[model samples]
Target: MNILNKTILVTGACGYKGTVLVAKLLKAGYKVIAFDIQWFGNHLKPHDNLTVVKGDVRFPATIPFEGTDAIIHLASIANDPCGDLDPKLTWEVSALATMQLADHAVRNGIKHFIYASSGSVYGVKEEENVTEELTLEPLSEYNKTKMVSERVLLSYSDKMVVQIVRPATVCGLSPRMRLDVAVNMLTMQAIKNGKITVFGGEQSRPNIHIDDITDLYMFFLERPNVTGIFNAGFENITIAEIAEILACKTNAEIITTPSNDPRSYRVNSDKLLATGFKPKKSVEIAIGEVIDAYEKGILVDKEEYYNLNWMQKAIL
Candidate 1:
């Protein structure tokens, strides 16, 4: 299952995680095929050993699956703000596109298929460590579609070596930088406004670094012996705790508000760790990296705020 000799197709290759993962795949010497519609519905660049396909996943289309070893389906309009932008568009792309991908990949003899699912698929995992077997209670429209997407991908399990990973709220530095994440937003507020405001500061959330997230995908891709579901979070901390971490680094005031924001949960990534996947980054690391970038003037804001549609993390 070495990636060096394999050919893999990663959907939405221009995204925050996708771009970073694509770079890693190339470094691993995989014959990488990147499918994306960056802007104006076009695949921007061409590289040696890399092919960019410009098309929408919502529409049934053919890929160069003849000798492809695997498919990492990372394309999706993730999050409530982004998905709610256009409900019709979200449904078509997220759920419908996923079904087409599974059906086509199997028919094309693609043996391994890795689906980029989310922890949001399980709306709230209360007391116990949330595992693959937890009952899903999706609160938002975006989450509902993701739950459906995972189910559809699972239906093709018998044909393809399907592995589903429900990653926690991803944070960390990226070349395609974003400030929409809870951690990133707090960092920005602490730096510019001198204070960070948080809603439901007591709400516990599962967090993971961006690099750790990419590593998990590659790990699962190479390990065919491991199948089924796994959670992808490192530390379980509260919202207030996240702000406190940034405050220590940025030296800003923390403002708390117990809003009925309706979001809280903790994840158990023990299953993923059992597969030799140990996350190297933490909330502190991510907060520090971002704060450093801002203080050093490397990531000064041209945009007043981050938008779900623009933030590359919105790509599941």
Candidate 2:
């Protein structure tokens, strides 16, 4: 499929990853219809090829899917904290809305549907590294909804090229930044508070740079024929290792705190790599970019930049 000039509808287009993905799509010559609720406010600049729409995923019927060749579903109740706040909302937006959009896309004759699932779906694993074939043991409502959405989307594979990418904890500098993620949180805490706390420091989690994940989405979007689920994680590192890296860079002391969230998993991305997709971005690179962003005043210290804080306010 020659993806050039193709119109794509991107849900959650104002999100941490969505803002970056929208810019990439526009630069790559794809006409983008950026649909989002603008939870953090729109940072995307005006573009002739870009169309921004303010909307909610919970009510997918109201969303316009007209003349869209592909759909990149990225909208949801994002993280564990937010997901736990209202599991009902999580199910409605993440699981139900996802299927609703998928059905709409198929009915509208859309060629590709890319769902941004998460590697967190693998949950706590005794295995060294969980592969695509492993049975998913999602620990949180967020991941559980992701699992359900994946199944729903895959069921429509015959009608459209339904693809799911299970990305790791995405870390990097974005126009709309998120400070609640593990890597970002640790880095930000070190910079702002002069201390890095590792809650359950030994727990392992796979991570990828934000740019790498968006680039992979474009990779899948361009190749419309390629379908199925693939893990989008690069390397599995411990929480303590991340804290140490930030501590070394910022001269901050590492603090260990007891955590109730003990979920940990190492994801295998060999299937994705076998397709010759190389991820150039690393956590070290992401940390540096974030630090640079902070120094330059590109990112600010605000509650809205954090998902949990924002969700609490939004729901109330």
Candidate 3:
């Protein structure tokens, strides 16, 4: 599918990954409709090819879908912590609303529907490398919802070209920066306090740079043939390993603590790689980018930068 002249609607357009994906689409000459509740303030600068909409994904009837060639659904109760806060809200936004949006897109004759699922759906596995075919054992409400949503989207294969990407924990700087994610949180802690905390650092974590994942979203947008579930992480490194790298770069002491969060799994992205998708950034490179942002005064350690903190104040 040639997305050069296509109009794409990106839900959660104001989010960390959403903001990056929206910009990439506009730069590639695709008309972009950015839909979000703006729980976070709008960070995107206005563009001629961009149309921003403030609305919830649960109400697909109210969101304009006419002339939309595709839909990239990203809006959600985001992470494990947020999901734990309200499982009902998580299901409504992440799973139920996603299924509703896909149904609506199909009814509107939308050609492609890409669902932003998470690698966390793999759950706490002892497996060295989890793949798309593996039975999902989602441990958290957040991932459970994503798993449900993926199945729901794929059920519409006959009606619309459905694709589900289980993206790894994304790290890197963005206009709408998030400090809650692992690499970002560790980098921020190191920069701000000169102390890096590693909670049970042996657990494996699959991660992809923010740019790489967002670019993958763009790649799937135009490549209609690549449909189905695919894991999108480039590297699987342990928490201690990540902290060691951050310590070397930031000169912070590694403080170890028994982990309260034991979720861990190494993901295999060979399937995604086979599609000729090359990840351009690495965890080390993402670490450097976060440091650069700090040096430039672009990002700081604040409640606003952390999702859980902000959501507590912003939501209920």
User: Which candidate would rank higher by lDDT, 1 or 3?
Assistant: 3
Cα error, residue 246 of model 2, in Å, equals 1.3
Q: What ordering of candidates by TM-score runs from best to worst?
A: 3, 2, 1
Q: TM-score of model 1 relative to the true fold?
A: 0.91
Compared with the true structure, what per-residue lDDT tens digits does model 2 show for residues 283-310?
Answer: 9889988998899988887888888888
Task: Please rank every candidate by lDDT, starting with the best.
Answer: 3, 2, 1
Instruction: Please list the residue runs of candidate 2 whose C-alpha ends up more than 4 Å from where it truly belongs after superposition.
Output: 1-4, 258-263
Model 3, span 139-250: residue lDDT tens:
8999999999988988899998998999999999999999999999999889989999888999888899999999999899878899999999988999999999988998
> What's the TM-score of each model vs. the native?
0.91, 0.96, 0.97
Candidate 1 per-residue C-alpha lDDT over 1-316 given as tens digits, one digit per residue, 9 for 90 to 100? 5556799999877766787788888878888988775631332345698888777777666455567789998888767887887788888878888898889898988999998888888876565578777799987778888899889988889998999988888887765666787877788889899899988798888888888899888888778889998989888898899888877777789888879866566798888888877788888888888888887888766441355645444443
**Candidate 1 root-mean-square deviation in Å:** 3.1
TM-score for candidate 2, residues paired by index: 0.96
Off by over 4 Å in 1: 39-46, 302-305, 309-316
Candidate 3 overall lDDT versus native: 0.90
